[model samples]
Target: MHDYTIRAFVQGNAEFVGFDKYAEVFGSTTFPTALLNTAVFTLVSILFQYAAGLALAVFFRSGFRLSGVLRAMFLVPWLLPLIVSASTWAWMLSSENGIVNSVLGAFGVPQINWLTSPDTALLSVIVANIWLGIPFNLVILYSGLQNIPGELAEAASLDGAGAWKQFWSITFPLLRPVSAITLLLGLIYTLKVVDVIWVMTTGGPGNSTTTLAIWSYREAFGTGQPDFSPAAAVGNVLILIALVFGFLHLQLQHRQEGS
Candidate 1:
């Protein structure tokens, strides 16, 4: 990469800097915080999203009355545009008069700042991201469940297996391939998330919510004095992270197949 400055880039005189920009990114104080935030944001969002989505998928597997309608409703969050969803979350989590705090107020709880406060800002964004991710997980996992033979569960039921036991021994094991892919895709998606957090916190009250993606965007465009090289380095770091996980998934899948 090159040491790209706005003026130099315009004049086509940007100087090649090799990996200097990467060194700068690694050495910067914000790098540690951004890396940690990115990990927390990605991991937490995936865990909860998968759990909630799988639960909903299993619930809907019963094919209850109006199940189709209910399942479709869950897809609303996923179908909504990112900006719209983020803006809606921002409004709902507004500290002064948010609907969340309003409900808390009725229960004798004080109004807590959701987005503005550094302490809760990361949490707020994570919650919003998890909500956005659930529908995708539900759809995928539900399809996976369908591919699994119902006869397996039926046999387990005949053997006196409880619902929980059937799920753990039969349903879950059969769903591993699907679950792995779902989690991998979720990891990739969550790793590079920008719009939702950007709309809600813009990296925050004090960098508490700044992930690698936000840091990269901030360096390149969030401020008037754009520093393009370091931003590119940060973006590359995210790509490397995603690739590492992608490779790991492949390796594990290969081992599973070999076995």
Candidate 2:
């Protein structure tokens, strides 16, 4: 890739720099923190999102009264625009007069800063992201649940299997294919998350929440003086990460089928 900059773009005077930009990005001080944040954010969000979604899907599958209405309500977070959701979270987590703090205050807890403190900024965004992703997992996993034959559960119950045993012995094993795909898709989505985080904390309180995606976006557009080449390099690294996971998924699938 070429060493492109905002001024060079306007003047058509870009110069080829080969891997210099990549070298610079890898050597930068922020790269390690960004990489670690990205990893923690992605892994934590996916794990909780999938667990909560699967639990909700199973709950709704029980055919309780008003279940449809409750499930529909769960989709509200997913239906709302990212900016709206992020802004709502930001408002709710405000240290002063926020509903969260107000409720905590009633219980004799301190008013803690959610976004302003480095200690909790990353956690704040992760919580918001997990909330946003649960609906997606719920929908997909719920559909997968439907494909499982009710007879299997019926037979397991008749054989004296408890709910937990039925779930572990029959439901979970049958849902493996669906779970794999859901996790893979969630990983890809979480990897490029910027809008929600940007709207909430702008990767701040001092790069505490700055993932690789944020780093790339900040370099390219967050500032008035854009550094295009390094942004491109970081973007490419993200792509490589996604592709590596995708290929690993394929390999696992192939191995499963072979076995």
Candidate 3:
């Protein structure tokens, strides 16, 4: 990145000159748009995924008939290959004849241009990612709940506290450490996600879905002027963000262990 394509140009691979990659990256009209899309996509997806995962964790933590089978079933989305998930979602979100639009039409709602419209393309990918991430969050949070002393919940119930109160007053508080780790890992993973977005929209509909990872990828791999320097610069920026969050996760884990 520091050399700014000088070596690549020397090797007759690139045509760009000067250390203008960074400037070009930041100055581009799509840069801020991509940043905004990334922030909104990651935050909204993680928020919904954590909530759904925690709810699923609580639901199946207790003994119930067929619970084991059903819990395993819920993980199918997470266990599927990234390419499979991406392709499946792409078809489901297709603007022409997707199942999603059909369902919406059946409910008297207008069919959505899910993957075609810039306004909804980012949202479409975010929904797919949330579905992909929930099972992972479920397993982690469920394990944390299992490790919590059951006596505390029993004691709260004995004190006449209802289920909701017991969860808020006892269970949820004790699940804090695990929740922090889940969210940190979610943020890091979501920041670098490329396959889903690439397959679904290719960061398209006029760059409405372009994110840091997608931007880096297109710069390095997309045809017509492949430049490694700018891609490296963008990728380095993405890695820096992930590393900061990873460092925080380690610190949080250390403090939890120390206490």
Pick by lDDT: 1 or 3, better one: 1
Distance from true position, residue 138, model 1, in Å? 0.1
Residue lDDT tens for model 3, 71-157: 999989988999999999999888768999988888998878998898899889999999999999999999999999999999999
Off by over 4 Å in 2: 249-259
By TM-score, the candidates rank as: 1, 2, 3
lDDT of 2 by residue, 82-159 (tens): 999999999999999679889989999988998999999999999999999999999999999999999999999999
For candidate 3, the lDDT comes to 0.89
What TM-score fits each model? Answer: 0.96, 0.95, 0.94
- Predict model 2's lDDT versus the native: 0.94
Cα shift from native, residue 129, model 2 (Å): 0.5
Shift in Å, residue 108, candidate 2? 1.1
What is the Å distance of residue 127 in model 2 from its true position?
0.5
Top-down lDDT ranking: 2, 1, 3
lDDT by residue (tens digit), candidate 1, 55-146: 99999997999999999999999999999999999999998868999989999999899999999999999999999999999999999999
lDDT of all the models against the reference? 0.94, 0.94, 0.89
- The residue pairs in collision within model 1 are none
